[model samples]
Target: MTDQFLHDLLGRMTTDEKVAQLMQLATPFFKGASNSGEITGPMVNMNVTDETVENTGSVLGAWGAKEIKAIQERHLQENRLGIPLLMMADVIHGYRTIFPVPLAIGSSWDLELAEKSAQIAAKEAAVSGIHVTFAPMVDLVRDPRWGRVMESTGEDPYLNGAFARVQVEGFQGDDLKNNTDTLASCVKHFAAYGAAEGGRDYNTVNMSERDLREYYLPAYKAALEAGSEMVMTAFNTVDGIPATGNKTLMRDLLREEWGFDGVLISDWGAVKELIPHGVAANEKEAAEKAIKAGLDIEMMTTTYASHLKELIEEEKVDASLLDEAVLRVLELKQKLGLFENPYRGADEEREKEVIRCDEHRQTAQDLAAKSAVLLKNDNVLPLKKEQKIALIGPFAEGNDILGPWSFLGSTDDAITVKAGIEQKLNKEVIAAKGSDIETGEDDDLQKAIKLAGEAEVVVLALGEASEMSGEAGSRTNIQLPAPQLKLVEEIVKIGKPTVAVLFNGRPLDLHGVIDKTDAVLEAWFPGTEGGAAIADLLYGEVNPSGKLTMSFPDNVGQVPVYYNHFNTGRPKGAPDAQIRYVSQYLDSPNAPMFPFGYGLSYTTYAYDQFSLSRETLKKGETLTAQVNVSNTGKVAGEEIVQLYIQDKVGEIVRPLKELKGFEKIHLEPGETKTVQFTITEEQLRYHHADLSYTSDPGEFVVFVGPNSAEVEAQSFELE
Candidate 1:
């Protein structure tokens, strides 16, 4: 439908009905009939009876196919105008067949796989009648101590952008109306929720405009470009105002400038919490303020349902704004084909067939293998066939293998590391619990140590628990939790060679363990097939190609650190540099423990001299930036050849380097390949003070490397 048709429909809506369109409740995917209304979380009320399904909004709990259909039917048959309620649930990693968390997927750095994951998720969700998903959270997280980092794609803006695009495409699909399996992708947390102060979840995000525009906005912009249907406002405040009511962010940047035509929904109860943000007089005022700021939908907040119409009648809010907000929502529903067939996706059989099928499981396994980042390999990994190995850690054998937001997923279905190792090994393997995840007890540690001492090889299965790095799981200290590190130290004390297989959701501060362990595998929370994939890499069945998505800081003080830092005039001069003068720390170096894009492989690779097609290029012209990479080691491996560009001189001092493009490739032993990146003037463009995007004519530096830190640079001029 065109704007004219949408306007006519908007003009026909009653004030109460328009308010109803803006209100969304927490309804689960599964459908149910409740004689008595139910209260959930702090704010949701679901009134489901034999006759009518009436409530502020509904929350989808652990409902399966039959239940999902049954509940949606009630909403269609009973609600006023038979306008079906918006269905939602935490479809985090996977609905049926779980995959690794966002952190694990980030390690892969393969946006295609990320996109595929989203597509499958959309397929399953659409089949189940879920109209929207709270995902593609494009928050640029700098602090690893924030637990929700596990749910993000990592700390680099470029990689996050690539991943966000794939996810957006996956959720929304190419065509929303035709793809019944496609649900509207809700790009989340409007602005800067990840830079929570002190790496704590729900803390204030105080960042400069230069930093926010240059770094954080890129991912959200990429998501929008990928066709996201909605955006969920974050819970945290940017500078001073909470995201739910931040006009500059929601209106000036997102709507007016970016021209986003999607519905803006609040993060659960974020609108009412404006009172906590001290921005609103009460919940009613909060509702008025959020809607006025261009927020189109109130998720689980009855404020819009109960207070918006009153605010309009009292002359506290404009009717046009409310109409515009409702129109956006109606436009989305119309685009989703909900207006034509409200029950188009309410098929029970299709939902069952799509959920947890073999195709989804296979994809999960492939992603699990791809997401495993090899941090260190000291010529001891890819263990020999007859080797006696000992696997140790609380996570080594448990079912709590899936990471956070894994709602209704079966832990019992998970394939443990021990099981995988045992199945693959011809010889006997001993496995023991090293220590409790949160606590550092000795009984388990002693047993683990004993097994390590006897075995020729020790595979220490370690890292944070499933809950340690997602949502409310933030921690100030990111070190390997206690006695587990001590257990590693004890096992290291022995003469036997050891490899550490870590399962974590965030970048951990492993200062002491870095050099001690012979090989370190950052396994992340690889889903049900995690064990099989780890074993495959352990025995050289698969080479480790994954790289670190987030920069691993050496210590807690350098919380917000990355590889693309600007050099100050007062540079740190080696270790002898005075700490008072530069960005250097008193106790540590200015570098991260593990830089962004840092990862190791069993096979060696060499970066040859970079060759450019032309050193000087005119406007609208292209430059072919090429580099020859050779696999020098015995076994075949894959490498992510990264290309970065630096603006040598600009009106504003640009970043030292920015990732331009990258390619992931597989090469056999001694195989050489010349990889090329097509660079255009668009690559040099930056957001100006006026928010206009344009490239300045100047000299540029192109750097090609295995990772951000180890790069070879060349210069060019753009006239």
Candidate 2:
């Protein structure tokens, strides 16, 4: 049946019946539908019961194969037109085989691997009958102060674009109709949500047209170009207009200019927020504005479903806009093959067979180990077999490995640090709670010290839970919550060789740990098999090669910092009489605790040299930039060969450096390998003021290294 069958059925229905299709209600994720207006309050309560999917208009963030299938079955069987509601979930990293966050994966600089992870997520999500995912958040994030930087691929347009294409392929695959397990990837917060004012969530985004076109639009374009079936408008505004209802943004840029023939879904309740932004008088007016602006779906907002039909019939809004919106929605269902095979994705056996399998666990472990950026390390790491280690912290024994938006994962099965260490060690290992997470009590500190006294080394496991740093989970001061810092400081006074293993979703201030601990490993809320992976790296089973995707600032005030920043005339370097007038801060060093692409390995590696195939090349000529990386350590390890490019004299001023390519290579002790990266004219262009992309004749520098901080530079010229 084409949408004509559904459309004709809808046509025969009463006004209330058509309105029901537009209405989207938020029900309890575990239960069904509810009359709850807003569930997220200060208490952080969740109202769940045994309710059917038909009571609510649509399901929001519901996972688990059994629950998801039941909801779908109910929607199809119970609804008046037998219309199946769209199932949405936040499959941010991985559905079951959890990979590192977008930022960490981006640090791998391996877009192929990133895409593969998404493919796995899509396969698992589709098994559960999920229609779409609010993912591949292609926000060009430059400010690390924003906790959600962990979710973005970092702050470069060209780099983000390349990664976006890979993610789209992973999510949508080649054929959506044939591949029901694959769902639509929603490239989110449509535009300029990353450049939030003051690094606050949902803050106003004020930027010039040139800035928006040049820096922010490329990744979203890349996703659409790669055949992303749908788009989710962002939560913030652009130039005083809310992105959910901005005609210039949604109509002009997304639909008309880009020729996107997909449905535009609004961020959660974003349509209803137009009133708060003073853009509309009420939800009714907001619906009128959003529908005209090209928003087809109103996620979690009742504005569209409740009022849009009334507005259309009364001539308050054109019925053609409604028709156009429904057409786009129907067309998407046709593309999904949902009309012909609505139950194609709802296979019970596939759901049980595919999710959280051994392959998924192994992949998760590999990604977790690879994402572990060795911030600071001494010989204390890769602990010897003879050593008796003390693992102490709130997170060590707890199975909280699943990060934010991981609704599908069960923490009950997550690997604990204690379990991981015991499996690898025959030596006596002492474990203690040490203290509470944020408030290290004096008695708890004494207990940690006592445990440290009995062990040869102390491995302090600390950091936030998965839910502490995601959306609406932002903190004012992103530091190691509470007494974990105090506990570590007291234990370090015992003078035992100490290593801090941090499990966090976002970067945290580790100044105290840096000052005290001999070694530190940022094991970002490594999902599910995190403990097993951490133990491998700790016991020398695997060498740490992961690099920092986001910078770790010394303090909250020193945030919005990154490695590829441009040089200012009065930067912190110059000796000045009055420092007050400069950009330098008085209280803290104007630098991050760890720079972007900053990581250390168990073994030492040296950069031999950088060489280019050609000094000058024609417009269409391909250039090869090569470098020799030698492992100069006793143990074998992996090295991430980073390649950065800079156009010295372009039509516009460029950043000091832009990451062009990277290769993660495995090398045995004393091994050397030559790595090469190819460059084209496309790699040498920037968006001009007139919104045109063109490459200029100029000198381009190719900097290669393990991370951004350390690199060997070579130059090439385009003729």
Candidate 3:
């Protein structure tokens, strides 16, 4: 549809209808219709009337084809303009067939798998009556203490931006108007939501504009460039002002500077919460400020619906802004083909077949295996299927493996570690529960130890419960629970080889488990097929290849350790440097437990130190760096060869090394593969003190190796 068509439709709407278009209510608001035509229950508390409900443009968190179709049918019958309701839901990793959390997917570093996961999620959601997904949360999180890090790809801006583009492409696809399996993607938590104070959820975020543009803003921009149709305001503030009402963030930067003309919505009552943030006195002021700040939709709040009319009537806000906001919503619906077919892809029959199908489960399993990071190994892995095994811990048979934001995913249907291992082997493996995620009696611990002693090997399934690390799940103490640690201590005393399979949402302090266990697999709450994936890794069916995206702290004291950090003037030269006056810790090491892009496979690879194509690169020319990587171990394996760069001198300080490029390649034993990378001038750009993104003419260092710490460097210059 053309712009004129949307304007014509908008011109026909009354003030109340136009205001209602900016208001998004939950599914229950429409369902709680009173016989006498008066709003009651939750809708009543929302300050909305039956008339307002009738004019509302969209529904939030609606599910099921039958229920959604019923609501839409009744809504179209009563609505005067015959505008269809847009259905939106939180379909993050997967809808019904759950995949590993976004952080795990980032560890895989496979763009094809990331896009495929989003495609499958969109397909399941579309069939189940969802028109839009509030997903692809691309915030770059450096602190594991920030619980929503599970929803993020990792801490690097370039990697996060790459995933953002591919995931957005997967969600919207090329033909959204005709493709029934696609969904309009809403890139969320705009500005700096991840840098919440104290690593707490919905806390205040304060950062310089230079830092925001240099680090936090790239992923959101990438998503917009990839065609994400909507943006969700974060629950936190940007520069001391709530994002929902901050004109500079929503208007001047997002609109005028970035050229984002898409619809902008709040993150669930964020408009009303501006009052609590002390930015507004009431919902009326919040409504006035939100619209003026260029927010198009107010989600699950009475601010827009209850107060927009008065704001427009009193001339507090321009009536033209209301029309433009309503027009944007109409344009989205038209692009979705909802103006013609209100029930765009809601089909109950297809929903049954596609929601949790075998094909989707298989893909999830494959990706889950790909996402499992091997944190520690002493050749104790790849257990024989016939070996007597004791599977012990809270998650041995528990199925709470699906991480947060998997609202549509079923926990009962999730496969447990014991179940997955049993499905593969002919004989049943004995299992015991040593401890719960938090606590257990000594008797249970003794029973588990005895079982481990009787078996030829022990596979300890440990880590946090699902609720421990997303959204409001921040933690100051990131180590495993004491009970689980005790279970490890007792089992390791049995003299049997132990392989710890950890299920978690964020990077953890693993001193207790890592030191005692013979091997450790960081199996982060691997979703529906998590158990199966771990079983595959343990039984040699698949080789573990995942690397860490976020750095695991040596302890909670080093809360926000990441590879891409600036060098201090008094930097500690080595892990055990004796320069007492330098920046050395009195009690702990400065390095993380595991560095970014660090993972161990059953096989090893040897790299011939990289060589540069040219000693100096001109502005318009590209420089290529190549290295020969050979598989040194007996078995074939996959390796993510990482390429990082260092700007020796900058107008502003730069990270010690920044990840610029990576290639995941598979090699057979003794097989050599030549991996090459090209460096462009754009890749060198960084925000200056004035926020101008340009590279200085100076010396640079190129680092190529397996991980951040174990790298070999070569010097180059940009002319």
Candidate 4:
């Protein structure tokens, strides 16, 4: 439908019908309307009537071709205007053929793979009748204690913004209405949801406006610029106002300033949550505040459904706001082609044919391999197949490799590590569950010891269970579980060659595992084909090239440690320096266990001959930094050459270094490549003390190397 047609449709809708368009409910409400409906679960007290349920404009958490087709057909038949109900779900990583979690995908530093994974998810989800996916969650997260950190890319505004754009392009493609295999992308948690205080889920977020704009808002802005059709409000409060009702944030910044005219939906029950956040008195007040704040949809709540019509009638809320919100909803439906065909892209045969197909699985396998980070190595990797091997740990035979938010992926289809290893070697391979993931009393430690004694080498598969990481999965202690550590200690006492393969979601403190293992691979929740990918890396079929997106702390007490932190007045000196009164920990080093952008490959590379095109840069000039990287080792490998910039002096203190650009290159033995980065004046701009974004004339330092901590530096002046 065109704009005129959508306007006409809105003109024809009644106040009740228009209000219903702004309300979204789950499948339970629809299933509980008649004699056949049981009215089970949480919807019992929602007081949702049959008319309200039938008039709802969207349905979430309901999929499958047959189920969606029936729901849409029924909704359209009952809806007086015949406006179709939009089907949306949380298709985070994959629909069936799961890929690595978002954090792991960030580690790959492969934008193409990240985009391809979203593309596959879109295709699979589209065929299953899902028109929208609440994905590509572009929140920049520095705190791993926020369980949802697994949902976001790591903590860099530039990196997260870059990935956000690609993910949006992959999901919506060029033309959303014409693309049958694509689903509309919704970039979520609109303003600083990831910066929850205490690193707790849904905790209050109190940050300066400068911090919000400098670090939190870029990725969401980038996604909208990439043409995302929807934006979801955050669950936390910005300053003292809940994001669901913060007019300054939702209206002034998002709508007026950013010009985002797309549908703005509240997170699940967030609009109603304003009452609990102490901003609203009741459902009517919550409904009024949300609509006035420019929220178009109240997801999974009856606040709008219960009180919006009365609020409009009493003139507590303007009727035009209702029409505008309804217009955005109809506009989205029109763009999704729901106006033409209620069951858009819902095909049972296509769903069966495309779900977890070989091509999709191959892409998952490829991404899984690229997402594995090599944290430590001592010539113990690339295990020889002829040597007797022992694969011991809870994860060796377990198939729970798919991380959280993989709602549709079945564990039955997941490939176990034992299965992947057996396909490679014909020799004796002893596999044992050394201990349970969190319990040491499985009585399998003795058997694991015997297997290790018989084998020439041991591959210890360890890490947190899949349940330990995603949403509501925060951990106060970010180290390996005591039982798993005990298993590692006993196995390492045997003194055989050991390789530790970790499957986790968040960055972990790996001091214990690193001390005992000869090689450590952080295979963070690699999806469906994760086991196969791990086996491939171990056997040299694939080289480890993934980098750390989030920094690993030395201990849990060093929470919120990131590489791009601002320098304090008293900075810590080198470990050898016995300096007092410095900002150093009494018992621990000031540095992270593993720095950001840190990873190891099977072979080594050397960086040399760093040069700059100019010693001074003008306001509008671009400077080029060049570095020569050579494969100095005996084997072929890939390297992520990183470029970082630092402002020598600023009105406000700046981070020690900020990642500006990076290039991943592959080289053969003895091959040398020249990596060049073009830095412009725009890259130097930052939010000043008064919140004005500008750059200062001063000296700047440029660093280029493999990771943030180890780099070669040069100086230049900005005029």
Candidate 5:
């Protein structure tokens, strides 16, 4: 377990054994292998030998305590030196008790809740015998067309970085060595995987060095600073070369400049993908480039196992690179205490007691409630319990609310909207499966309309199916399916007070539901306790405190619209700009349908008396900006106070506003509170043309408001 012992172990490893350490195969490879080393089942074509299988350093997608225990026992018994297999899985959102998607967690804007949710996820996964989790994806996304946007927090680098820090803290608790409930968090897609072209998955990513550092890379840096044990290479090309084989990105910047000594892993089959990316011609070249580029592990690929030895023998790659990679892998295993106790936290009895207990489910429900954003609400919301209710749509009785990336969560255990409502009121509410996620028959529409006639209120549960968003779930049209919209139109004609509760993964265009529905709630893929949490919001048991982390477009045409955009030279509607020739769309507004930090509550708050401590801020000194906020409505509610900064004039063009910091506070009806934010010279520093991180001496403006669109501004000078 010591460093010396790891080095000694590495020194004894043969070329074949060392290469096997870099390969990560599916759980089935080990389970299906015979005692005679004959590769069987799906991977027979791979021609992998039994020795390689037995000496394999890690196993991917291995779940459940019983299965992992069996795999580890056999691996140690058959191996020459008995190195335990490192078990890993995609415990993205949850293991069994699911929580809302990462996008929704960003909407909550509550660091404590985000951290707690990750901690719960780690606890569940650790009990199931997983030693590492590929999570806290933290790729700052702006375009909604990318299906993986659901995995990220949102568009802003600052917000995503903040969440990344806490998620790492929660996953790798104060003491990873002693804490059985903790997991070794793997912050993924190392470089800018989120900036795929046209929001397409695995597309080429091209951006200037300044643009890349300024907008992306901050969250990954923050996660490393927070002590993540592993980093996964992206599947896309950074600059011109594939990230899996880009030596400048993986070695110069990450391993050398940043000093990230953690295990560098390749995204699924990414190392071999270099061949398809045109960087490498064959498997040997791919393995050489990936290893030389500092990739420690190749997930679901045979390039490392099949050709690493040949590349090392031909003198194309050094043997020291293999030693370094194997040592990193062994260090990780020792850190995980796999050498001392192979089954560190895997207990079949304790698994049942911890997986989806009441405490974990309560946290999931609470987070889902806070993560649900109130996008639009008329006086009709917070429905009266006594009012007759008719809940109808694809999601009425559908239980696919766990969202994508929830690989272990069971739909059978998911509670539906109908089940949630009846459990809350203790009586059956009339419900109808108006349509499937795509379309329905004419009789379905008539039946839903008739059901609306029986109730005083209609709650429409609709949105994209769990498949429409996540991983390969991108879409050109982000509106609700035509069938759901048609069902909405017919129900709206009936004239009952309507509320559209959307269960989706990405920020939707919301054309049909927004205008026709009297009220709208963005309940984005709420997990296992989704139905119950939504029921809580409908009956006023909980107030909505979530905000939009990503902007919702008016239409797909305004795909990348966000609040923190540049003021172009030919700005639209500027005082000095001309009319039609400006940078304005003829058919649509440049602003988003809903800006970042925009959310509504059952109650309201007003901001006034904004002031700054001084007009001039000197170096090595700080300034305090304060604003008096009052609850103007009757009910008590929680509000997120956002602080945005804009450099009036800089060396280069600056954005209209950039969110520097925010605070979420509670207030009683008619209660007033003075919220203050301390601004320092460091907060204004940005990557200049030469990538110098320093603030320019100039005029600056600070704004405080409920959301990004509406605010009260005050100006100051940095001297």
Candidate 6:
């Protein structure tokens, strides 16, 4: 359909019909008349009726070819204009073949793998009739206390922006209109949802516009630039206005400034939430504000359905705004080819053939392997196949490895760590649940200790339960659960060689576990093939290369610790210097337990011979920074050579260092590789005090290394 056709269709739609196009409801609402659909929970008072459901333009949280086809067929039958219902779902990581959570994927630092995971998710979801996935959630998160941090790529704006673009490309492909395997991408939480106050979920976000642009908004802009078909408003308020109804953010910045003409939908219940957010008094006011603010759709609520028509009739909202919103919806449907076929990619047989196929599962396995971060090692990794081993923990044989937001993945199909290791080793292994994820009795600890005493080495499978880390899963104590810690303390006292294999979603304070374990592997929710990937790394079948995207605090008290923090007036003194009035913690070190970009491999790489192509850089000039990286250890490995830059002086204080570029390289023993980074003038620009983005003429420091904490430095001048 062309623009003219969409406009003509919109012209034909009644005020009621147009209002319905802006309303999205769940599957239960469309379960037929005999079903006598009843509202429950939050919907009981929402005033949604069967008639409203009949006219709704979109359906969410519904999938499977048969079910979606039935819904579409039924919706089209009742819809006044026969506008096909847009089907959407949360296909975050994978559909059936689950991959690592977004945080784990970010650790891989491999955009190709990240893009492939999104592509696989699209392929599986498209066959199931999902038109859009609320994914590539590119919120840049620094605090792990926010449960949804698991949904985002880590703290860096640049890295998150890079992943956002590639992931969107993977989901939509080059031609979303023609591709049967692709689903339209909806980059979410439009503005700074991750910076919820005090790292709490769905809380207020108050930051300077400069802070919002400098640190948070880049990823969303990048995704939109990459052609995401839609954007979802966040649940939080920006400044004092809720994002769903923040006109300055939604209209001035997103639509007028950024030129995002795609449909903008409110996050689940966000528009109605404007009442609770103190911005609107009732559903009528909420509906008026959201539409005027440029929100095209209201998800999971009846604010628009209940009051949008009346609001338009009263001229509270311009009729043209409603038409424009409806136009965007119809345009999306036309782009998805739903206008031609109501059941666009809904094929039951195709869904069966594509869901969790061997090829897709293999990709999941490979990504899972690349995502597990080696946090600590003491020659205990690559466990000898012949050694007597004890795999002890709740997750040792548990199938709950799939992290949150993996709505389509089945735990029954997930491979357990016990299962993966059994296939790798012929020797009999002692496996026991050392403790429950959050609870452990004396007997459980005794059994774990007995198993450890009998085995030559102990592999302690530990970490939070899958429920502890997604949405609404914030933690004040970002450490292992108490019972699990007790179990670890007892097992480590047995004095056998121990390897701690952690499965979690967020970065944890691992001071206790790291000290007692000979080796620690952060296998963050590795999905369906997680167990197998862990086994591969344990037996030397694969070398771990994942780096930490989020920094690990030394304690929960250091909640917002990140590597790119600005220097204070009174910086910390030297390690051996007396701590008097300097900015140092009284009881803890100022540094993080595990810095960003920190990871260990089975073998080591050495960095040296750092050089710059020029001592001075002029405006519009690009400087090449080169460093020689060598595999100095005995075994083959992969290294993420990171490049960071620092402005020596600025109008506004700059961070100590900012990650600008990185390269993941694989090398054989004794192999030498020269890693070169071309730094452009654009990379030096930052939001000034007045919020103008520009670079100052001054000296700059360039650092290159394996991680943010340890790096070799050089200096250059920008003219």
> Which digits, one per residue and each the tens of the lDDT, describe model 1 over residues 203-307?
898887767888888999999998888888988888688999999889888999899979898887789889988999988889878987899877666687768
Q: TM-score of predicted model 4?
A: 0.98
> Candidate 2 or 3, higher lDDT?
3
Per-residue alpha-carbon lDDT of candidate 4 for residues 526-597, written as tens digits (9 for 90 to 100): 999988888899999898999998998887778789988998877777455448878888898888899999
Instruction: Put down candidate 3 lDDT per residue, 1-719, tens digits, no spaces.
Output: 67787778888989999998888988777853222234455556776787988999898888888778888889999999899999999999999999999999999999999899999999999988889999899999988888999999999999999999999999999988899899999998898899998889999898999999999999999999999999999999998899999999999999999998889999987999999999999889999999999999999888888788898889999998898888888989998999889998999998899988999999999999999999999989889877889999999998999998787888998989999999889568778889989989988888898898889999999999988999899999889999999899889998999999999999999988999999999999899999889999999889889999999999888877889988887789856556786776789999998999999999999999579999998888999989999999998899999999999999999999999999999999999999999998888989998888899888999999999889888888998
Query: How high is the CA lDDT of each candidate model?
Result: 0.81, 0.78, 0.91, 0.90, 0.91, 0.90
Alpha carbon RMSD to native, model 4? 1.7
Model 3: CA > 4 A from native: 32-44, 574-578
Identify the runs in model 2 with alpha carbons over 4 angstroms from their true place: 1-19, 27-58, 78-80, 426-428, 571-583
RMSD of 1: 2.7
Best-to-worst order by lDDT is 5, 3, 6, 4, 1, 2
lDDT of 1 at 551: 89
- Residue 672, model 3: Cα distance from true site in angstroms: 0.6
TM-score of 5: 0.98
* Clash list (residue pairs), candidate 3: none
Q: What is the lDDT of residue 140 in candidate 1?
A: 86
lDDT of model 4 at position 230:
96
Q: What are the models' TM-scores?
A: 0.94, 0.91, 0.98, 0.98, 0.98, 0.98
Better of 1 and 4 by TM-score: 4
Structure candidate 2, residue pairs in collision: 22-305, 23-305, 189-234, 190-234, 438-481, 438-482, 438-483, 439-483, 440-483
